[model samples]
Target: MPSSPPNPQLAKRYISYTVDDIARLFGIHRHTVREWIKRGLPVIDKQRPLLVQGADLAEFLRKRRDARKQSCAPGQLFCLRCRVPREPAGWQVVYRPLTATQGTLNGLCGTCSARMCRRVSLAKLTAAAGNLAITTTQAGEHIDECPTPIVNRDFKEG
Candidate 1:
């Protein structure tokens, strides 16, 4: 699930928080808060209960959340299955306009063969096409087509 934007009001109200306070504030398990501490969340440890400063925690969370965001260059699209930006297998992509200004770029992942797509502005399409070979089509032209069939891999339970 995606996280909501940080609340400036709440961040300004509290100077510090305990593990339990952080857990309750985010409606998450206390173990998750402890995990955050292990993940480099700064804390004040001189007292009996470790305290996480509001500014530190905010910055930590912000950085962590931002780290997950991936951007695609002109010739690339983000593959949901692989969770990375990848070029199309043949350096070719299909564009389907969603609106006057926005559209979707579709392609096959060069590595994993997953169907990949990324939303982009129409203004950028020309620059993106210059970087790669692109075929523009109507919305319903090739919605059902896939360059490669998806293979399901079974994982063994630990």
Candidate 2:
């Protein structure tokens, strides 16, 4: 199997690529290119060396790439284990700020109980929260501001 998906941009739209040409371009085996032809990748005609139009190849690859994407709706978080956008359990979410302008909304998946979180800009946090009740968690003080050494800042003696 190929290490990674082939880039659709490598196919020049106007050119026609033979099986071997496409295999070399994508760094996959020539038989794998033939397998792609069998799997609905279009070919010029039923000739000896199969000819695939670059535009068709690019379009096919683009569709494959897009089909694998899972986008969350306004109130949902993507669950890694379930591989779907899911509502948080109990309609509650916790917001922990990572920066002055951005934070993460953390919750448990309604379906699987797997931890789910989404990074959102502070400006858009309300929109991201949608109908869910959200609680904002305060960030820890910076080391210099703390009387004792901060957990993440350093272990230097106060």
Give the best candidate by lDDT: 2
Q: Please give, for residues 1-158, the per-residue lDDT of candidate 2 as tens digits.
A: 45446789999999999998988887777766776686678999999787999999999877655633656778887664564668999988888887899777888899999877777899999988899999888876321121111111111211
lDDT of 1 by residue, 32-81 (tens): 67766976888877685989888888887666455446567778877756
What candidate 1 gets wrong by more than 4 Å, as runs, is 5-67, 142-158
Q: State every prediction's TM-score relative to the real structure.
A: 0.51, 0.49
Best by TM-score: 1
Residue 105 of model 1 has an lDDT of 80
How accurate locally, in lDDT, is each candidate?
0.68, 0.74
Indicate the residue-level lDDT of 119 in model 2: 71
lDDT (Cα) of model 2: 0.74
Enumerate clash totals for all models, in the order shown: 0, 0
lDDT of model 2 at position 76: 88
